[model samples]
Each structure stands twice: as structure tokens, then as C-alpha cells.
Target: MTLAQRTPAEEAPAGASYPDLRWFPPGTHITVRGLKKAFDGNPVYVGFDIDLPKGKIVSVFGPNGCGKSTFINMVAGLLPIDAGQILFEGKTIAETRIGYVFQNYREALFPWLRAIDNIHYPLRLMGIGKAERERRIEELVAGFDLKFDLHRYPYQMSGGQQQTVSIMRSLVIEPEVLFLDEPFSALDYEMTLIMRDQLQKVLVARGVTTVLVSHDLEEAVYLADKVLMLTRRPSRIADYMDVDLPRPRDPSTLTDPRFIDLKARTLEVFQNAVRAS
Candidate 1:
């Protein structure tokens, strides 16, 4: 049977079946049902379920080794799950269009290709013609308000610039979902701040369903509409807190009482998760 036809029992994880059909919350964009994974005989996730909302940014933060990157990778279909099903708006991964921005910009971009060419590569793979590829690239360049030249090779550009290209490449496809795994971790403090602002503008404007995995607490709360915090191994949701802070959040937002309080709360949950581990 096709994925869409599968019953709730069929969608359940191995050895753990449920009769009730999984109910997605309103505006849910992605659904993960009974997700299970293991490596070297050690279980990471077992019977995990989550409903990610449409047109919003959800940041995944947790204690170290709590499977933040693992979660997104599995959802993005980069890594295989041992069992269970992940669907995008009731469609399987093959039927979904996705974009991923890896944390390591230096390794993610093509050293030989010009920045513009890197952005065009995915479209080419999708059988998009040269004319359309050029049009999309032009649109993204304009949307990003790019100041630097795109003709330069990745090796010649600064770290922040390379990451910018990586983001643009992911976005060029206009994917239904965008997964970013620590996209700014390598940049210096000054550059990280700038990239955050740039990313926020494009993502909010496009309203793509985005899942970001970050190690930094402040960065996680600053950029997210909701923060999904996980517990230690055999990870479970510690808290899925809504970030009600108004956006176009600037550096000044850091000092806002609400922002500060939310960050403190997130940190507290994180510390408790760690201690429990």
C-alpha cells in the first residue's frame, strides 16, 4: 500500500503499535510518527513523534548528544531511520522538495564551482533549464540583497560569504522545507550576528517550514518561532516552548526582558536535561 493509505498501526514503530490515527495539530507541515533509530546497538530515538508547523522556524536545541542533528538528518532523509514513517504534508520524502544547509560551509560548497554555479546546481539536477535557473538565481540574489560578487570561487571567499552561498543554494529550489544544522557555528561572533540577521529576513519573508539545529541557546531562541528542546539519550521532548518575541529581532532584542526571560528558561531546561543525563 502507498504511504497515504497506510493505517496508523502500520505507521507505528517496530514492536510498538497503536490503533489511533495520529492527529496533526492545526497548520502542521511535517509529521514524524513513531520514529526509531539505533547505532552500534545503542538506541537514540524510540517511538518519537512530532508535528512541525507550517511557515515557521522551529529550532531544535538540547543537551550535547541529545540527537539534535540526528533528528533533522532523519527528517531530511539524509540518514535512514531504523523504523517508522516521516511525512511532509502527508507526502513521503520522495514526493517532497527539501533544502539543507550543512554547518560546515567550507565542506558544503564546491571548491571548483563559482558561487553562482553552486546555487544553480540543484536546479540543474531537477531538470530545470538554463533560463529558469538563471531566473531563480537572479531572484535569490535580489532577495538576499547580495553585495559581494557571486563569480568568485568558494576558496577565495570569507567564511561568512561561503555560508551565504550555501544558504542561497538551498533556497534556490524554493523548497517546502529547509533544514539547517548549525549553519553559523563556524563563523566568528561578528559574522555570526550578521548572518543571523540575513537568514532571518529571507526565511521570514519566504515563510518556508524550517528546522534548525543549534548548540547555542541564545541563537536558538533569537531565531525561532518555537524552540523544541529534547532530553538526553532515548531523547524525548523536554519542552516545546513558543517564542512570542516580535521579530525583525535586532541585537537590541537580546536585552528585551521577554527575550532574556525566554533564553533563561531555555537554559534552565537544558541544564536540567543535562543533569538528568
Candidate 2:
């Protein structure tokens, strides 16, 4: 399962510019086929295949060590695929602009830089002009209605604030394929609720095709337009479910009979996966 470790080098070169972003358009659906990966000769994923729909939130649910992050990292071009293709808009991952939010918000954002600078960092790397960079930041903040003081440093802000910056950083580019690896796992109860609502609003409005990995059943069902249930190691999609719930999912969505039923079904499959593994 070992391939060349330098696959990331094949992506858009460091000095290259970010491509034009299409606003209000649902980006391409990602198509994966015969995907394979291994770390230190240990297979984590094998023949993993799924089609992530356009402008939809697909929450990936699985037990611990199921290679959720690994799958996403490979798609984000942060890690190389040993075998198979991950296609989006007729191009490979290396050819596309990707947005990834790591689970560890504490380590994701640079401590020395201000929150505004952190959001601006990705745009900076892409050689975005100051004017254009400011425009992107303004659009993202205003669109999300985020009120965090970006002038403060990451260490100076609350955990929720720091994670918000991480999310903003990942999203500044408005990538077609956005990978959120346990994006809210570090937040408090109140912050989680806020982030979930905020994420739904922005993503739904802009129509980014998001893939989220989460352990929280309620959160998964709450935010997802669909859910991809994965098995244990050497993971594969056990079931693909359409949410069938109404939009603008609020606190009331939790009490809806359909939501409760779907949540229970997802949990049962997850528990079965844990034991079968």
C-alpha cells in the first residue's frame, strides 16, 4: 500500500496563485474509487469509495481509529494516496484548492499571530494582494456573522474563539471540498451549539461541499444533509443515509421525530461497528 511520499509536492506549486472562486454555486461532488492508504505498513483504509454530493454536508461516523482523518487528509492533499483516484470538478485533489480544519484548534492557529492574521495567512500564502485578502476576510466574517476580535492572539482568546479562527482560516479560500476533522470536538457545550448553527448557516448559504468527521451523534445528525457510516479499521461506508429533515436545523430539529429516529439508527450502527471491529 506504500506509494511515493512526495505526492503533496505534485499539488499546485508554492508560488502559484489561488484560482478564481465561484460564488453561490454548488461545487463539484467528490468521487472516490478504490482508495487505499497505509501508515508504516499498517493498512488504515482499503478500497474506500463514496460520492460526496454537491453543496451538501456529509458527516462521517465511525469508531476510534477508523482512518476518518486519514481519508480526509489524503483528499485534502495533505497526505498522498497509495492507490485510486479522488476526483472533483474533473481534476485531482492536487489540482484543486482545499480547505481543511484540524480537530486540534489549539495547535492549528499560530500563537504569535493575531486572529485576523491567522485568517489572512492562507490568502497570504497564495500570494493574494492586500486588497483582495481584506475583501475575502471581510466577506467570510460578515457572511458568518462572526464577532470575534481578530486583533487578539490565539492564546488570548477562548477555546471557542480560537477554533472559530481555525474555521475561518480554512474557509477564507472558499474551497470546493472542505474537510472538517472533528472541527468542534474541542469546544464547550455552548460553543458547540453556536459553531454548529453558524456552520450550517454559512455552508448552506455558500453551498460548500463539506465532509465532517464527528463522534457526537446529535451533532452529526443535526448538521449533516446526509451521513456516511463507516466501519472500523480498513474502513468502508456501511450505510449512506439522506437526512430527510427540514433545513435551518435549530433546537427544535432535535425534538423532531425523524431526527430522533435517524439519530438512534446511526448510533446503533456505530455501536455495531465498534463491536464487529
Candidate 3:
């Protein structure tokens, strides 16, 4: 239970603790105990327990509608947990500083606002001063190597640019935990690769605990320190794979024997879940 405070871009007070996660040990930033959820008498999750580690990326993958998004949404408080608890130490979900990047970038963006404004929107809501907001957004843009102009409206940008804006919006707050729901699903293969690298870079620099939902096997392994594979109805974590690939990953990483083996093993887990269902 000794995580260091996650300071923001040159602005957090000297020696201030980031209360969002500093109290928890590295391996249990968010603990879900006996979690359960259902809709109309049908269960999605039952008696599920998992520990989301501090400052590490955990990717969740499973068959469609197997409650991956539902799980994270419950954790994020977008929806209520039917039972059990999701907690950061003793804090409620809302007490934590959380950043969420939804799967649909276009829908999430403010059409009338410039990309920069959209990214700055959340900070403004939190009452962050203009100068401090600029510093944080600037850090995110520079860290991600975003080259696109942010003055344009969301409708004027391409899918990738819009998503990049969405990502920056999530990161501007320097959240203690970040939730990404199929963040790259809208991009093409090349753009997906580019976005993945950008995400990894910022994550490394920020050291935020992250939970990602990805459908792509390669992507799950590429971005995660560990992959949580889910089962069908009455959803549960069917298996877990710790990805040990070297950092600063590239296309070449996909070819490494280690990466290949990890993907194959994860794919097998999903395949078995399918058969069992």
C-alpha cells in the first residue's frame, strides 16, 4: 500500500499525495469483490472478484456482450453494480480521479467546439485555471506527438484525429486511473499502430493505472502488462495472461517469438471460452 502520488504536468504542489491511488498497494488499486450485475433477471456478472493493479495496464478481452464494458462501466459508476463492491482502498468510485475514453469518439466530442476546447472541457468543469489547463493539455499533446491542429471542430477532423482528441481529453486531468473502451477500434491498421504507440508512450510517462477493453488479440497483448480474458453469461475472468514483452513496442514486436506465443496463448483461452459457452 505504498503507491507514490501521480503529479500533473509541472503543476502539482511539491510532495502532495495523489489521494486517488496513493493509499493502495501496487497490486490492488481497484478491488472488486463478489461483484454481480443483471438486467431483467439475467445476470452479467456473478460473484466476480479481481484486483486492478496500480500503475499498470490491464486489458480485458472476451466474446461480444460477455460483460466487458458492463464490468468497467460498473467500476466507473456509469452503471450501478448490482451487488458486491468496487473500491479504491475505502473510496467510492466517484471519490477517485478517473479518466475514461469511450469507444465512440465522434459521439463523445463537442461538435461546436474546437478540438482543443473539447479536450479542455473537463478541466474547466473541475475548475482548473486556464494556465494550468493549458500546461496539462500541452503536455499531453507533446507527449503523444500529436501533430494535427486542435483549432478545428470535431466534424472537420478525421476519425483518428478525433480519437486522439478524445484521448487527450481523458489525459488532461492526469487521472489516477484511466479506462479505455476499444479506443483504437475506429482506426485503420496503420493508424491503430500509430495510436497504440502514442498511448503506450503517455502511459509510461504518466504511470497511471489503466483498464482497457480490446477485441484484438495482438492489441490486448501489445498494450497490456496483463490480459484478463472473460467468460460468457454470468461473466467471470476465465484466464489471465501476463505479457512480458519489452517496452516501446513496435511492429517488430508483433514478430517476436515471445509476443507470438502470448497472443496464441490468449487466443486459445478465448477459443476455449467460446467452446464451453
Give the clash count for each candidate.
Answer: 0, 0, 1
What lDDT tens digits, residue by residue, belong to model 2 across residues 99-121? 98899999988998999999999
Backbone clashes counted, model 2 = 0
Q: Cα lDDT of all candidates, in order? A: 0.93, 0.84, 0.87
Pairwise TM-score winner, candidates 2 and 3 = 3
21-108 per-residue lDDT for model 3 (tens digits): 3333456788887788999999998788888888999999999889889988898889988788788755888899899999999899
Question: How many pairs of residues collide in model 1?
Answer: 0
23, model 2: CA deviation in Å?
27
Which is the leading candidate under lDDT? 1
Off by over 4 Å in 3: 1-26
What TM-score would you give candidate 2 relative to the actual structure? 0.87
**How many angstroms is residue 142 displaced in model 2 relative to the true structure, after the best TM-score fit?**
1.0
Q: Which residue pairs come into collision in candidate 3?
A: 1-25
lDDT of 1 by residue, 1-277 (tens): 3454355555666766444454667699999988999989899999898899999999999998999999999999999999988999889988999999999999999998999899999999999999989988888888897779999999999999999999999999999999999999999999999999999999999999999999999999999999999999999999999999998999999999999999999999999999986
Best model number under TM-score:
1
Cα deviation at 230, candidate 2, in Å, is 0.7
Q: Extract clashing residue pairs from model 1.
A: none
Model 2 lDDT vs. the true structure? Answer: 0.84
Ten-residue stretch with the least lDDT total in model 2: 1-10
Residue 155 error, candidate 1, Å: 0.3
